[model samples]
Target: MDPVTCAGLRFAYGASPVVCEVDLTVRESEMFALLGTNGAGKTTVMELVLGHRRPSGGTVRLFGRDPFRDRRRLASEVGVVLQDSGCALDLTVAETIRLWLRLYRRGEVARAAAGLLADVDLEHRAALRVRQLSGGERRRLDLAVALCGRPRLLLLDEPTSGLDPQARERTWDLLRDRRREGTTIVFTTHYLEEAEQTADRIAIMDRGRVALTGPVDLAASFRRIIEERIG
Candidate 1:
């Protein structure tokens, strides 16, 4: 089954439509990228996928289950790296990861969290407090937490935001490794170059609807609309 499906998805806030009649599907183990400017509702769509917000119209199915009604089942299969790292500053890195791991059932908490930190190149910083971590390190920690549950579907919002070129490249490599291991990844990023290099398919959104979607080749079509910039 497809990892995610959005059929005729529609959302509104106080009678103002943010998204209208949007349709999307993501096959498992594929790299799917959602592209849009701020306020285009990319994050809104993700929230719906995560069951944080229910759709006002249409239907959303995750792994063939209704996200709202089968929330626990849905949560077990999906992991997320939100834009914000909500961990307390006083918490040590290991402590923060351990806390997140304990929320899952039958997981190798200590071993998995340690492996995840290594996977994201954060092993060296594992002893630091959340406050002592650099912004990039914090983001990596969030990614590690998302991986602890061994989810089939991973959702990342601006996964490489605020990182230097080297760190961003490292992140791209890590995501590719995960993809090879059969994990479906849906990511939202304004980083065109990163998407061009990392995504198997791209969906460009404007005004809360997909403007175009296809393989990386679609970038050529988008060039006329967007200026060329790497960051």
Candidate 2:
């Protein structure tokens, strides 16, 4: 079975539907990207996958078990980096990572977080307070924390938000390295370039439904888009 699978997944807040029936599959050691505009229900889909939101219909499975019902087991395997996450403002970066280590008796969480920060070139700021970090730096810190759990499945919701071009490239490289180490990655992003760079496959959503889903190779798709633009 794929590491993650969803079939006919639907969600709504009250009577208002946010995500329409969606089907997706994610495999181990592969990077999958979800792309869409603002309010396109990308976050809702992710929440359902993470078990933070219950599906109104259909099924979501992580390693062939129901995601919402097996959340505790899923937690041991899933590492997450969300777009907006809270960090104690007074905590230094190292301290923050160590505290996260305490949450799981994961012996190497601190070392892992530090290694990830170093890999992302944030090692120099390791002692800085959360409130003192720049927007990009804070985003990197979030990713570092996500890695602390040493997860098999990494779910990143807009992982590169606020990063500069160079930082974004570096983050892409880091993800590539992680995938090489056999981690399954599922992430959301609006940037086509980021998707093409980091994803093995792309699922594009529009108006609460998937508009396109395929391998990320832009060779033909970009040509079609550019030809239309030129015409």
Candidate 3:
């Protein structure tokens, strides 16, 4: 079964519906990108998949099990990095990673903490407090924390948003390595080029519905489709 599967998924906040009849499937080791404009319900989909919000209609499954009902067990297999996550400002980068490791407890977190920081180019800031880091540096720190458990499914929201060119490229390379290691990744990004360069399959959402879904080879066409939808 696909790690993530949603069929006819629907949701609403009171009188207004946000997601309407969305169907998507993310295969194992696939780098799936969800692209959309502001208020297009992309973030809502992420919340649903992570079981942070319940679906009002249809179904969402992770590894063939209902995500909401099986969330406890699924936690071990899923890693998520949201756009803005709260971390103790006083905690150093290394301290934060070690603390996250305590949650999963799969193995030696101390040994892996250094590597995680290095992977995101935060090794130089390992001893620096979280509050002392720049916006781009904090984003990288969030990534490092999400990767602590080597989860099978990774969900990232605007992961490289504030990063510089070199940092962005490094983040891209890290994703490539994760994909090679059989990690299924799902991400939402406003940057079309990031999606075009990394995603195997891309889904573009507009006004709570999927406007375009296709292979990256056809990304040029998808770009036009997104523009038309926005216009």
Candidate 4:
């Protein structure tokens, strides 16, 4: 079964529709990227997939189940890193990771926490509280928490936004590892090069609609589509 499917998906904020008739399908273990200019409803689509918001029209399905209705049952199989860090501010970095590990019922909390921190290069900041960490550090912590369950479906929103080049590359390598492990990843990124280099397929959204969906080889075509739509 496809990991994600959305048909004629629609949503709005107080009557101003943000996602209109968006249709998408992500094959299992595929690295899919969503690209768009600001206010193009990329994040809104992610929210619907994650079941954080109900679509006003159309349908969203994950593994052949309703995401919003089956959200709790599906939680264990999915990992998510949104733009916001939802970690408790008072918790230390290591403490936060350990907490998620326990919630996910992972064995050997100490070892798991150490490994997760290392994945995001947060080992050095293990003792720092969430509120004490810089924005980049916090984002890394969020990623670690998301990976706690060894999820099959990973959703990332602007995952590398605040990182330096080296850190960003590390994040990419980590994601590549996940893909190799048969994890299906869907992400939204403004960096077209990231999509070109990492994604197998991509969908470009414009004015709340998906203007194009094609293989990464279609990067040039994507540019032309956007130009024709917006110009």
Candidate 5:
């Protein structure tokens, strides 16, 4: 089954329609990128897929089950990194990882904590409290927390938003490793170049709908599509 499937998905905040008739499918083990301008509904679509919001119309299924209804049962199989970490500010980095491992019911907290910290290059900051870390460090900690369960699918919104160039490259490398290990990743980003380089398929959103979707090669025509659909 596909990791994510949405058919005619729709959502609105009262009378303001945010997601309108979005149809998207993310294949298992594929790295799919959602590209769009601000307020184009990319993040809302992610929320719907993650079961954080119920769509007003159409269906959203993850692995053949309704995501919103089955979210608790499916939590073990999915990892997520969103814009806000929401981690306890007073918790040390290692403590935060340990908490996630415990919540996920993962054993060997010490080993797992070390490994997760290493995965995001956060081992050096293990003793620092969440509030003491810089923005990028906090983001890496969020990534570490997201990876606690060895998930089959990862949903990331602007996964590399605050990192330096080197850090961003490392993050992508880590994601590539996850993909090699059969993890499906679906992410939204404003970074077109990141999409072009890392995504196997790309969907460009405009005005709460997908304006174009094709292989990464479609990036060559991206500017034209944006102009045509968004202008």
Candidate 6:
């Protein structure tokens, strides 16, 4: 089964609609990217897929099950790193990871914590309080914590938004490694270059619906759209 599926999905806040009749499917082990300008409803779609928001209409499925209805059963299989993950600012980086491990799994908590820290290149910052970390560092921490349970599907929203080029590449490499290990990833980004380089498939959203969806080779079309939007 595909890791993600959305059919006729709809959402809104109050009377205004944000997403309308969107249909999408993400294949297993593929790196998929959702691209759009701010307020284009990409974030809404992310929330729907992660079961954080109920769809106003239609269905969202992860592995053939409604994500919201079967969240607990699906929790271990999915991980998410949002732009703001609501992480505790008071805890040390190491403490935060340990805490997540305590909440999510049973054994090898320490070992897993170590591995996650290494994966995000934050081993040296382990003792720093989360509040002390920079935005990029905190982003890395978010990724580390999201990976605590070793999920098969990873979801990210504007993950590289504020990262420097070096940090951005590192994040990409980490994701590439995970993809090599057969993990499916779905992410949203404004950085067209990054998406063009990393994504196997791309979906461009406009006015709350998918305007275009295709393989990465659609770069020429992508450039034209971006130019049109700019001009």
Model 4 stretches astray by more than 4 angstroms: 226-231
Candidate 3 per-residue lDDT over residues 49-154, each given as its tens digit: 9898899999999999888888899988998898776788999988999999887794777778878888898889989999999999999998888888779999
Task: Give the poorly placed runs of model 6, Cα more than 4 Å off.
Answer: none
Question: Which pairs clash (backbone N, Cα, C closer than 3 Å) in model 6?
Answer: none
- Worst 10-residue lDDT window for candidate 4 reads 222-231
Q: Write the per-residue lDDT of candidate 6 for residues 121-187, one digit (tens) a residue.
A: 9999999999999999999999988888789999999888778889989999999999999999999
- Candidate 5 lDDT over residue span 1-231, tens digit each: 998999999999999999999999999999999998889999999999999999999999999889899999899999999868889999999999999999999999999999989989999999999999999888888888889988999999888989999999999999999999999999999877788899999898987998898888866566676555544
After the best TM-score superposition of candidate 2, give how far the Cα of residue 89 lies from its true spot, in angstroms: 2.2
Please give each candidate's TM-score: 0.93, 0.91, 0.96, 0.96, 0.97, 0.96
Task: List ranges where model 5 is wrong by over 4 Å.
Answer: 227-231
Greater TM-score among 1 and 2 belongs to 1
lDDT of 6 at 24: 93
Clash number for each model? 0, 0, 0, 0, 0, 0
Between candidates 3 and 5, name the one with more favorable lDDT. Answer: 5
> Residue pairs in steric clash, candidate 4?
none
Q: Which stretches of candidate 3 lie over 4 Å from their true place?
A: none
lDDT for model 6 comes to 0.89
Model 3 pairs in collision: none
Q: Kindly provide the TM-score of model 4 when superposed on the true structure, using C-alpha atoms.
A: 0.96
